[model samples]
Target: MNASYRGGPTVERILPNEEAHELLGLVTEIADGELAPRVADFETRGVFPRDLVRTLGRAGLLGLPYPEEYGGAAQPYEVYLQVLEILASRWLAVAEAVSVHTLSCYPVAAHGGDQVRKLLPDMIGGELLGAYCLSEPQGGSDAAALTTRATRDGEEYVVSGTKAWITHAGVADFYNIFCRTGEPGPRGISCLLADAGTPGIVPQQPERTMGLRSSPIAQIAFDDARVPVDRLVGAEGFGFRIAMSALDSGRLGIAACAVGLAQAALDYAVDYARQREQFGRPVIEFQGIGFLLADLATQVAAARALMLAAARLRDAGRPYSTEAAKAKLFATDTAMRVATEAVQVLGGAGYVADHPVERYFREAKVLQIVEGTNQIQRLVIARSLTR
Candidate 1:
């Protein structure tokens, strides 16, 4: 199967150099050859593709935007996000895992001490998988209100908390756990990089989610998990800032994933319309079907453009938090719309497992909720505008 399916609309990319173009080609080739074929089976079985994570790591895709000294490709955010889009069009679960892994690495790479940063090579190289623990049962959108606590005790910080909706959960090699260390609110928070095998750390069973089952989201209970003081990322009381900063970049990753999923749904719908017939003619020839497809295609293109614009702003060191939020909001909303329309285009056939449109529809709903909810994106944008 073609990664984008039957030669979809050509998205003209503004890559930084010839090397970036070559990298994109490599990603497309790998996505088509390795990912597209196995996605359906893995998704149907709800099995995590661990080997593919290593495959992506070996391809240098897992660490695209980080510095080369730490086993990264050092690509610009624009190029890196487009690569994610390509992968997502083929396999959303794999692409989402990559995004979460990248997010997990940011706290250490950006804020940790030199000793802590040394492990980044292994993390980025795919030798070690990572997870970010932030959301608690009581705190989903209100991250500042998280109740997980980490108390300083001589050489180690004893962590105790339950983190909900954690991606990678039990399988991650390391976890960046955000917890309270001082008073209540964001100021009391600190980030700790804890090994997965640490004593007192327990990961509950994976949630039975509506989609992305292979990604393995679960609740992690850090029952006095002892983490060395040296593992603390940044200074105490700065974890909230680090988390927010990482989220700005992560939201863009989700936007790229949304665009790819929307593109996939649009492709499937177009292909089905051309092949299926009604009234002695292809369904695509009917004005109603054709117009709907046209609108979905336009939406996909517009979302891609918006996402890329945010990525470029980030790459240029501009204040792109607002732009990223807008991209996340618009692109994810577009994904939901396009997927829903794609299902309608297929009618009953789209609802079944025989086609991927239904899966796309299910997966698209979470995009609007994760990273930051669409409602939160609006608030972020409003704050930026009003400020």
Candidate 2:
């Protein structure tokens, strides 16, 4: 069974410049040579690829959209998302890790005080892995109803609560902890940057996820963890706005990941179909398999286009939350559909680990659930329309 499937239609992208094109070429080279070879083994063992993430960081892939003064590449959002798409084509877990880490840096980068901005160098450089702690077990979608509390205790804030479904939970060097500081609503929330090694900040065991096993997801319990007042990311009562802003960009990242995953599935299924034979001819020559592959290819292309359009909007510094929602909703749904049909195209072969389609199938399902559920994305878009 070939674990790496690199064959696919060459996408023609209208990049902003030669530098962006070269950057993408570098990413493609790394994806094929590094990520493709190791994904299967890492995923099977359920081991986190911290070293590979470091490698990506060293190569400047981790902070593409951030300012170069903070050790980032200062690439546009459009270019950054393309890098994510390329990475995700080879390995979804790694791409998602990059996305989450980028998101983790948002609160400080966008709204941090002058004191907190000093940490951007390490965080953006990937020397310090970061996690965003927003969704509590009971407040995944209803973020405004969060129960976590942070009280001002002289020079420190005593944080006490559990953050759920946090990627890079135990392994991260720092976390962006969102907790209530005043009244019970979005207005009361505040963001705090806490060291993962802080006493009383305990990480629970990693969840046995259905896919993306190479990435860790767990609950982090803050048992009165004392974060210094200086660690506050933004002004008090501003965490909810910071979180929503970060999520808009995060949704674009997930949408790009979905496009890559779907492309990989379609490519694999097409390759198998071309070689697979029945009735004295290739199976792809038959209308049933041929049409399915055609539709899948078209859908993947459309999803990529939608995702890129949203990224371009962000690049233009326009309001793109609704567009990001639409892209995340469509691209992930397309990935699920494409991966499922890829399995069907391969018949019995896809059901087993002998082919990568099985892994792609499992991986695609989680994209619909993560960042925000497709249903939640619909709600965001619908509200945008009515509002």
What is the C-alpha local distance difference test score of candidate 2? 0.92
lDDT of 1: 0.91
Error of 2 at 355 (Å): 0.9
Q: What's the lDDT for residue 338 in model 1?
A: 93
Worst 10 residues of 2 by lDDT: 1-10
lDDT of 2 by residue, 1-387 (tens): 377666466678899999999999999999988999989899999999999999999999888999988898989999999899899989999999999999999898899988989999999888899999999998898898898999999999999999999999999999999999989899999999999999989999999998999999999999999999999988899999999999999999999999989988898899889999999999999999999899988999899899989988998989899999999999999999999999999999999887888999999998998888898999999999898
lDDT tens string, model 1, 1-387? Answer: 222242355567878899999999998888888888888788878889999999999889889999999989899999989998988888899999999999999998889899899899999999899999999998999999999999999999999989999999999999999999999988999999999999999999999999997789999998889999999999999999999999999999999999988988898889889989999999999999999999988988899999989998988999899999999999999999999998899999988877788889999999999998999999999998887
lDDT of 1 at 200: 92
Supply the TM-score for candidate 1. 0.97
Q: Model 2: runs farther than 4 Å from truth?
A: none
TM-score attained by model 2: 0.99
Q: When superposed on Cα atoms, how far off is each prediction in RMSD?
A: 1.6, 0.9
Q: What is the lDDT of residue 241 in candidate 2?
A: 93
Clashing pairs in 1: none
TM-score of every prediction relative to native: 0.97, 0.99
